[model samples]
Target: MILSGTYGELRSNHFHSGLDIKTQQREGLPVYASADGHVSRINVQHYGYGKALYLLHPNGYTTVYAHLQNFAGEIQKHVKETQYKQETFEIELFPEAALLPVKKGELIGYSGNTGSSGGPHLHFEIRDSSQRPMNPMLFGMDVPDKKTPIVSSVFAYPLGADAHINQSQKLTKLRLIKQMDGTYKTEDVISYGKIGIGVSAYDQLDGAYNKNGVYSINTALNNTPKFEVKFDKFSFSETRYLNRYTDYGYYKTNRSKIQKLFRESNNPLSIITNEDDNGFIHVQDSLDYSYTISVKDYKGNDQTVIIPIKGTKSEILNPRAIEETEDFIYSDHATSLTKGKFSVYIPANSIYEDIYLNIKADGDTLIFHEDVVPIHKNITISADISNYLEEDKDKLFLGRLNYKGKPYYTKTSRKGNKLIAYVRLFGDYAVVSDTVEPVIKPMNFSEGKWISSQKELKIKITDELSGISSYRATINGKFILMEYNYKNDVLTYDFGDAINTETENNLKLIVIDNVGNSATFEAKFFRK
Candidate 1:
């Protein structure tokens, strides 16, 4: 049976596409097949769903196994052979129809924290034959769940000029009070001209206390549906628009996940199940109205909240107002700053909204939003480049330093007007590279030889810059594939092929980095 550890949440940018399976405390737990299927796809990436496998079952469903520790016997052999031939660490392969078949209850792989996973667990997913992800708990996974969801936060938004929250013309958080029973009630009555709501909440399974995202959310006004969204499935193409579905500034600053209790103008999360009267409810003059919101998981467990809004048409106490300025030019292609430390030049017709910029000078560092445009504009930092570099002034490049410890190249040049930086906005950083070599560590068997029946090999690779690019392996001097899963930075090789009825075999492994640095390991082993 398919089990649910967490339900998907309809998030901004993209839908929470699958259920996360708790792996009982740690990694390396055996994962079983849900139905008869063939291994259709295998992907080993540096980030985001590392060491993932896709199986196509007979019932027009495709199951995904992500953050895997290692594949099973025959499957491991096939993966290793390809890795050796390609001589690379990251790979994506679509196998033939009959390449690797599986039976229900059969072992497919081991669960681990890989890719973009934040902790140790199995990131399981169910998709249609078309590869669109669906909520796995819909398949009747037997996970016990009795605890109701906790409504940790609520946000009310003023969508239009006349809208208000309580009595103010700004976004406000409603205080919640839990009565003797488990149900939650609002502490204050809300009054507004016109407004919408947003919520930030999660669910929990019985066996595992880990908090998981909720599966669906629905809202109604006076028992008439206003909006609804389900997290059952979504396409990756819509993932980035998450900003449209959330309070971006709130998430960027506070790190809280707040699903805009109400849809905004032109927001694009397609999972929205209901949209009525522009998703804004009017609080009629001197009238009382009822609002209800329901949150649920994939197994049908649910929680409902009732809100009574006593309407009073009132003037705004302090109106939120922004003064329009003509000194700084705003256009679809670029934002010209007359008073900031940086000026951004975007390609024509690229900006979606009038950007509220926060630009400043911070001692040799020039920073700006990287996603507003698609052109090469430079941030002329006050620092003198002659202090940090050799005579090749024209060849000096600018780069965005990433948290992954890799510096990505950006097209930049220094001229009299300013330092021109050609970049795509959002998450760009200034970075430089180093010539240091990467470090590799083999956990068990030494560099020479060993005698044992161990079926797995484990190694760790680390680099200061540009990170580990790829890795390869060989058995008895013959090529073997070593899948490098960057999430855990572990290189794994199965002994299915290197083993024979009789005694001894030699194994060699090599790992390489983006800067062409390399490391090698050789050993001898015996398998009975």
Candidate 2:
């Protein structure tokens, strides 16, 4: 199978967690089960792993198939029946082991660009007995490769306030030089105290040209192993640790993944093992250390980088000083700030370390610092909107203001005068109202037309301000299932299951945006 992604690849706020198999940029190719197993779990959603299936094999392993355009004949039948019974398009189902069984290489579903997929590909995964994702390449999946991993960038980081790199208290980017023997060497650095290293690199296979995740990274000093990291297996619960695993602040502005070699106090990623100094290197007063960094892919191809560090006596200069403000919020404990009609709560452990937050209130907007720092969990923002007009209260909700003065909708709950919004991203917050309704237009069938020969009904729904919250479709005053594709904002309904007759039918659709703004569509069609 052709691959587009690698397991445990560093993604935004999480690991890739699976391998993406290329489907030729199209859907509807038959997907087969990997081994003899029973249908254990199936989940269908508008985002994430859309139309995903899980199979539990007797060998204490589970396989997953995701981003399918449609399931096989039997699987599709069962899913439709369940959707109609529940009156909802997005649903999760689990059949008893005896009911749905499959042998090795049996057809299960068809590949599609469903869920949060950027293109048409199948995201396949294999888990161990504990349901933790394991590298499928380890299970004899042959991936032909001869190219070595590419080292794009390398960095030297001063770990603490006492440390200095290149005679300055800052992070320094090292220059890498490629040698004739196909190896990388970074310029020698004069550093003192505790220091860490980071690298930005990727791997590529033989046939596919896409930059995939490196399988393993090993760092050594003076012929002794210092740290080792592998992308073999990991737990889903620890996936969010990816933010701490990488240089989050650098990635926010640069959009490049820089994996830190040293583990932070809060980064509890399981992929790192066999660490000597926890991936940190200490330098003596007058000495130089030789370092080696090796990156490899599953195909046994590898690349190496030689880094030399010279110890120099230097003092930390111009360290970041915590600013004092009227509303300074510390991250160690629960911190709250209140001013005007705005209040915020930063829960304990939501932040990785002690951070000074810049908060203020101007007019009706509450500024909770810019989006520069990384937050581990969500902080609640509350505003008193009792002054708003009673008639417009339903339209008013807590919104995160963007640079263009537009509001990004969040699920806001109100109790009396307090409107609360729990957000993970740090930004300006305010009470914004959205009164414009959504727009719905038919795609496949038209008004007053015969759709007797059509297989499905499709409608496109869109909202300019607040995003779509919920949508429902009804036929003859009864609820009918309408599958929503959030990527394109299109809702589809199969005529075979819901409209299986040659008669006149009345259809009604109701679509609502985030802040109570809604629109309705009704039409009549002759189906034979």
Candidate 3:
């Protein structure tokens, strides 16, 4: 099997917690239990790991199979009954040990393109008893991997205010040349004071063109180990530390992850080992240093790059300047600022470091700095909405504008005359309104039609502004489960549920948007 994503790979806001195995661009592939275990838990949702199953093995490990089409045999029966019992499409259940047991290699479910999946694939993960996801490759799961990792770019950064690389205070990209022996070397770098290194690399397995994450990276200075990190396992709580592990500011602008060899003071990621001075190299006058970085895959294939550094002090050509602003946010202290009708509150430790931020209000929009800064926790942004008419208050909401200046919904709440939104991103936000109601249209059978031969019913629902928040459907005055696939904007119901008891049935569906705008549809169909 091939992989689309790797464990501990860089993802938005968090690390990829599992391996994404390619399912050949189609669904309904057979999925088997990894070991003889009981069905511990099941989760069905419109987002996240849709139709996921958890199996608890006796060896203190839990194997998770996510994005499944349907469960098999008795497991499918139990899930259907529970959904009807709860009268909801999204449900979570913890089955008893005696309820559902299966042997290893037994059929459990079929692969699917559900949840937030980009395509048809299985997101597989193995967790310890403490629920930390461990690399499945460590447990003897193997794929054909004889290829080495590719280092695309290398950069040198001045760690301190006075440090300089190549007589410049800005981060410099080093050009590399490949040798006949498959090793890389960079030209001699003239530097002074302390500096850190960053590398962009990816791995590709045998017969696969997808660029995946590497297994380990090690850096040495003057033949002494400086920093080392391996992607074996990590806790979910610490995944957001990825923003700190890499150069967050660079990623925000360049759209690439360049993992820094040096660790920040507040970075608590547990993946690094055997480090000195947090991997920062202090260059002294008249001293020469040889730095090497080794990137390797899980199958022992490695690629090394040699960087020669010479400690020579030169004239200060370009110096770094600190940008100062009236709003100075201390990382260790709670701060609140207000401008016009807009206000923002940042809690202690929400930011990685103390920095100057530009916060101001332009008309109804709040410009809360750019996204170059990484936020560890949610901060509050409030806007006074007393000026809006009472009739339009129900349609009012809070949204963040993208680069194109289009506003998208952000979860907002109304408290008195204030519209509050807790956000982790630093961007342009505005108190906007979504006055459009959701669109609900029947996909399979229309009104006053006989659909006796149809085995299922389908309907398409969509929203233009705040997006669909909740939807409910009833047949013959009784609530029936209608599974929603947000990926396709379709709601499906199986005829086998037998909720329709009479020959002539009336179906009523109500879909509500995020800002309380609702739309209703009613239809009549005859089914045997």
Candidate 4:
């Protein structure tokens, strides 16, 4: 099977925990159990791994199948009963071992595009008893990958304030030349002091054109191992450390991830092993060094790059640029800022290093630096709304500025006269008022229409402002389970549920926005 995303691939905010298997660009593909196991947990939600199932195998491994369309056989029946009993579509259930045991290769579910999925695919993973995800390729789930990894770009960074590369204290992009025998080489580099390297590369398996993540990356200085990182396994708790491991500053400007060959002081990713000086090369005067980088795929196909370095200690032509302001945040200490009606609280260790920030407040807007730096933890921002009337307080929320300079609704909480929001990125924020309610329209069967041959009923629900918060539907005063697909803004109810018994039925739906504005839709239809 071809893979759209590989295990341990670089993603926004975290590393991909599983392999995304391509489903031929469509849905409804039969998914079978990987091994003899019992259903341990079942979760149905609108976000994340929607409609996911966890199976505990006899070998102390748990296999996860996510983004499913529906469960098969008894599993489907059990889930439906639990939903009806709980009166909620989003529910988590754990079945006992004797209740839902299955043999290997048994049909478990059908694959579909659900929960935060970009398209139709299956997100499959294998985790140990401790819940750490391991590469499925190590467990004999093989994809045909004979092609070597392609190194698209290479860069050298002046690690310290005194270090310089190519006579500049900024990161320099090296020109790579393809040599014979399927290898690469870079021009001679001149520098002195500690410096690091980074590379952007991808792997392409046979029969698939998608560029997937490489399996391993290694670097050596003077024939000694400097840094080694393998995508074998990693824990979920340490996944967000990906930002600190890679060149996050470059990613924000270039829109590409460059895997750094060195480790930062606060980066504690278990997948990496650093040698002397944490993978930083200490170039000294009157010395010559040979640096090598090797990129490999899971199938042993590899590509190598060699660079010749000359140690020449010279005067600093271009020094590091520093932006300092009156406000400074120590990485190890908590700091709070208050200006007018806005306030911000940053916890200790929220940043990897101590840095200066340009923070200010203008009326109702708060400018909290830019998005160049990566934050390790969340910081809280609160805006006082005591000046607003009591009637408008419940309809107000905080919005963060997007890339397009437009403010979008953020999850907010209220404490008396304060509207608080916790965020990771530093950007412009302001308080916004949303009084508009959600809009609901019938999709399949309209008012006073007969839907005798329709297999399901659908309605389109949308919110133009603060977004939909909650929704509930009932048929003749009885709750009916309606699956909501937020991607398409469609709410669907299967006729198979048998909720509509009489020839004529009345349907009522109530949708509420995040600002407490509610809208209701009512319609009458003949189903029999």
Identify the candidate with maximal TM-score.
4
- Please give, for residues 450-524, the per-residue lDDT of candidate 1 as tens digits: 636467777777776546666666776666656566656677666655533445667776666654567776776
Superposition error at 463 for model 4 (Å): 0.8
Those runs of model 3 whose alpha carbons end farther than 4 Å from true positions after fitting are none
User: What's each prediction's TM-score?
Assistant: 0.77, 0.96, 0.97, 0.98
For TM-score, candidate 1 versus 3, the one ahead is 3
- TM-score between candidate 1 and the true structure: 0.77
Q: After superposition, how far is residue 404 of candidate 1 from its true place, in Å?
A: 15
How displaced is residue 368 in candidate 1, in Å? Answer: 0.9
| lDDT (CA) per prediction | 0.66, 0.87, 0.91, 0.91
Tens-digit per-residue lDDT, 205-320, candidate 3: 87789889888999999999999989999999999988889888998899988999989878888888669999999998789999999999889899999999999877769887
Q: Could you give the candidate ranking by TM-score, starting with the highest?
A: 4, 3, 2, 1
Can you write out model 2's per-residue Cα lDDT over 1-528, one digit (the tens) per residue? 678999988887889988999888989999999999989998999999999999999998999999999888688889888888888888999899997898999999999988999899999999999999999998988777788999999999888667888887666899999989999899988888889999999998778889899999999999899999999999998888888888887888788889998887888889997798799999877998998999998887889999999998776564645666665555568987787899888898787877667888887898888776778888988998888888887787887888987878888988887788888888888788788999999998888999878888999999987789999898878787888998888998877675545388889999999887989999988887
lDDT of 2 at 145: 77
Steric overlap count per candidate: 27, 0, 0, 0
The Cα error of candidate 2 at residue 77, in Å, is 1.2
Pick the winner on TM-score between candidates 2 and 3.
3
Name the lDDT value of residue 33 in candidate 4.
97
